[model samples]
Target: MERTLHLRLTCGLLASAARLTPVPFLDDFLGDRARRLMVDKTLSAHGRRFPSKQVAPLYADPHGCLYGCLLSAVKLLLFPVKKVLTWLFALRYLTRDLSDAVLLGRALDGWLEAGRLADATDPPARLQEASLLRSAFDNAVAGTDMQLLQGLLMKALRGVSGLPKAAWHAVRRLRRGGAGADPTEGLSQADDDAMKRGTAKLGAALETPEARAFLEAFDARLAENVRILEARHASG
Candidate 1:
């Protein structure tokens, strides 16, 4: 019965994604732009600095951006279907593809590393990349899969190595907190503390309304996703 429900949910998500009829040409254009932005800015510069080691990282950014663009386009196309389906499908695709997660992380890392933080001595070239990463994270957290949501959050943090040591410690603490608990049990005190610390660090560094909004949205979404997953398991 559990397996059957999983299959049904998965199929429902896939069907929704398949039925989406995005403006292919526009999506293609935006994807190309995102790719060009990554390559011309971060990847190309990084490649010059570390020619041999840069390919994988550079490729990941554009790949993730393209995937994100595709997902966004699909959401735009299927907007009339019900917002929940759009959120679920977008989350599923973002979490399912390892490459996509890597790319998304790299993109975020690049932005953070480029000194896009509010506390940076100097502002970076553009804020678009950081915005994209936040969007991806938000979408993933709002989905139905608790494990995937946590995994994606970890991946995103791993990519942002430039985040303060405090942030990294917070992530580790959160991981440890969630270690023994069933995914459906919700976040432990450690997890809550980790989130609070990370959010504080972020808020201090990037004192922007948008940034705070994203953090709040993420917290809400994560809690909601966990509740949904737990309810599903309980029902089974």
Candidate 2:
């Protein structure tokens, strides 16, 4: 998932949020697509299975993996702020293509997770920074956020209290229908199929010589970024 991220850097600074680690143990909140939505496929039905063979090539050829980017972006956004920033910094800084803009769409949920963006001393600048961050995120990933939103709505419905009998029945129906299969997602079969094709194609494309060269470059860039991060964050 990290390898195939559709990275776009909005600015040049110590940006971060999405982390590179295993998902926290989510309860049954995740459905059958648990594995897929676990990493960076919240709304995507593609199940974000980055088989070891397919990882390098997809990173090498970003063009062949827009769906992968979207999946990665969407999945990354669903996490808490720290993890999201980690993922963003990694993708935005490590990729060879610095000209391409990386969307911080995941940060739009800053309101949901206050302090995700560090607050300035002055209230005005703090508000302005948060607003800008949200607007940027809205521009990039709002379309995909709908699926995440729907899943959230389902969770909300399930969490609803003191609802009327009719409303409770409606919520029950929704759960029994599509929500039961994958509680954390609402992607249709078509969306799932598209992800399948995208994942397979990118995986296959990475096998080429061109992709191998790109992978070599990417590795160097990633190592360089890690060194920079260590230098900046390490204890004095």
Candidate 3:
């Protein structure tokens, strides 16, 4: 029964996706439609498998799925806008005449440390330097502390101890017509590359036993949540 329901939901989503036409800023319509169809079909299938008196839970599942799908889709659509805003703010901050390189350095250090904790890996010292450089670029965009910002950024590039040679190479490449000589331009390009690499790494890592176990646990929780909703509907 679950297999049949899953297949039906998948087909519904695909059909919705196929029906959408591509357009700038409106591409999410297709994904949104697909997500809605998936949720609706899943609930409908559940309703058919159970009697009308027992269909309340299935309806609740669809409701929850609909909200989750919409939130996810909206977030995905807004990600590009957020990146652009980040770049704009960073550029504005870099062209100023403020003097707080030391403070900026501390902030960058803390941010890098937090990133390391999140990733559970000891990234090279160069990563922290990269973080500071990136921060300086952001500060310039935000139009704050231009002199101090540049000083902090240069310090990050040169004085930051243990910076990876590869990072310096990448920075040099950016400076040498890799992209716009603008700091934001180089930062954006590097970010894109990093995202691509991170995604690839995550895909590979998900194949490990630990990742598989985590996925299994997550799936179990999802199923339990659905069942609980179903029970509430039944009781109502």
Candidate 4:
């Protein structure tokens, strides 16, 4: 569990940093990859061989897709305004990814618990459980006070102020090169180092008093809700 949390943090940082890439849509691609990586690692820890591709459809549905699209649209609308203020943009991006990481980690935990409560070989049962888990998770996320997460993330980013600024500069450098900049090649060692530092900072942030307090409240509610849902399903 501790290892999974750390993996989520690293992946969150990587995903957030991916947004700094100047190429259009590349950030979404890299962010999805980071999420898949988190899923893979979490499954591995549970001794489950289910690859992310196989597990994806279990949790994915029309509503989830719709929610994701809506989120993307919102971010698109805000990009221009947020882009002008590097610190605000960085904080928003970090909050987005890190909050996503927290939700995904909890969802993975619920999925694992679902698998444990049912026959591991029963695909249908597992699918049903995943569906229920997804619904619960989606509802919880939608109802969550996102501003609380943004505040926590702001506090975290402030702990290492220079890193986000350096990352912002790297993004600007890539943009200045315009069409000539290959997104893949645009990342220098300095950019990589900034990402590494950011990742470390994120991990450390998770251990802070503020983070722990938030997680305790959020995780308890999410976990209990999931458990009750699973229990009712099993009884039925």
Candidate 5:
């Protein structure tokens, strides 16, 4: 669990860095890669090697994809004046992407554990799970206090300019080790402080009632499927 937390925090920090990209869709592309990496690492930690063919389908969220397209279109339209407007939108992006790492990480971890308990062998099961999880998550976050989350994360990360460097180092270490590396290691004093604070802030947000219900709801969904599978196994 500690290792998984580290992975999520590291990936969240990496996603936050996408705000630095001057090109809009480029940041989205980079953020998507970070998410895929998170999914792969999370599943690997659960002792399941994710099939390359399933990666795309497992991460597909129809609403998120549509949002991404609309976001990219807006960015393109404002490209000429991004220097003035980027900062305005950066906070929202950071809030969404960072929280996504935490939320998605937790959801994937729980779902995979349920799959294991049920002896689920088919890869397609993951796609079905992903669809339900994504829909549920989207609804859950609709009531979240975006402004508060943005403020907490932004304040924590504001003065620590070396954060990007720390994130980069963590990414390099993860790639080198492939798994089990702490994503928050080797940071300078300021970077470390910011990371700790930022992480705590994220935790606080996720501990909210809405967030708690989301996890519980997903858990119930998984438990039902597990029971069904267990019954099938027993019958066979």
Candidate 6:
């Protein structure tokens, strides 16, 4: 989903009022490595027909964990030594793929809602909500970006095979329902002090009336999202 952001900056003040989108193209979240794992899979054998180049994907549905397990078992039988890593990759990705998509969409929605309360919005956020923003969020809630979610998870666990201690820590984080010190702590290592300073600068802009309201509500909103994800995991 998308919306045109119109802004006129003049002499340090937003003349036409700055309508900024804080998040980037969002599709940027999933890099190439994970995308390949989630969307593409090479078949071990020919199709039900004779040998052919056409190989359908192993796991296309995010919520299909059982299916992923079965696929993994099948791959294991055909090529134990050569495909262990790829099998693990698919299994790990599909485990929380669907649920994580909802979680990510919720995060993005929270960002916009949080941002709307940041300052006085151009058209006034109190008026009916922005249509484009609503569409974007609606799609997000529908789990439209499974590849992005799966790819990101794959990236976070990237070197786990070589680092047993880190792998255990990652497991602990997941088993604790992701509610520890840093709910999204895995991503924090990617942030540098310079990035922190840049973020602080950007955060300073939230001083306006629209955005100010979100500060008070932010923590509660975040907690709610965590609970939602945890609850979904528990039920499954």
Q: What is the Cα-based lDDT of residue 212 in candidate 6? A: 42
Tens-place lDDT digits, model 6, residues 14-59:
1000111112211111221122221111111111221111111111
- What does the lDDT read for residue 144 in candidate 2? 32
**Residue-wise C-alpha lDDT for candidate 4, range 1-236, written one tens digit per residue:** 44565566656665677676554455555655566667666776777864445555322333556687778867677765544563457657787877888667766766676554233556665555556666666666776777776676657556654565454544444344442232324566765555555566666767788777877777776777777887887899
After TM-score superposition, the amount by which residue 205's alpha carbon in candidate 2 deviates from its true location, in angstroms, is: 1.7
Model 4 spans with C-alpha error above 4 angstroms: 1-6, 17-27, 57-90, 110-119, 159-196, 227-236
- Compute each candidate's TM-score over C-alphas: 0.23, 0.26, 0.25, 0.62, 0.61, 0.22
TM-score of predicted model 1? 0.23
- Model 2 scores worst on lDDT over the 10 consecutive residues at 9-18
Worst lDDT window (10 residues) for model 1? 4-13
The alpha-carbon lDDT assigned to residue 157 of candidate 6 equals 32
Which whole-number lDDT from 0 to 100 does residue 112 have in model 3?
Answer: 36
**What's the distance in Å from true for residue 145, model 5?**
3.5
Each prediction's Cα lDDT score?
Answer: 0.37, 0.31, 0.34, 0.61, 0.60, 0.30
RMSD of 5: 6.7
lDDT of predicted model 3 = 0.34
Q: After superposition, how far is residue 108 of candidate 5 from its true place, in Å?
A: 1.3
Pull out the clashing pairs in model 4: none
Order the candidate numbers by lDDT, best to worst.
4, 5, 1, 3, 2, 6
Candidate number that wins on TM-score, 1 or 5: 5
Q: What is the Cα-based lDDT of residue 197 in candidate 5?
A: 55
- Model 5 residue 124 CA deviation in Å: 3.7
Deviation in Å, model 5, residue 200 alpha carbon = 7.8
Candidate 3 on 87-167: residue-level lDDT in tens?
A: 455433221211122222223233333442123333443333333334343443344323433443334233323222223
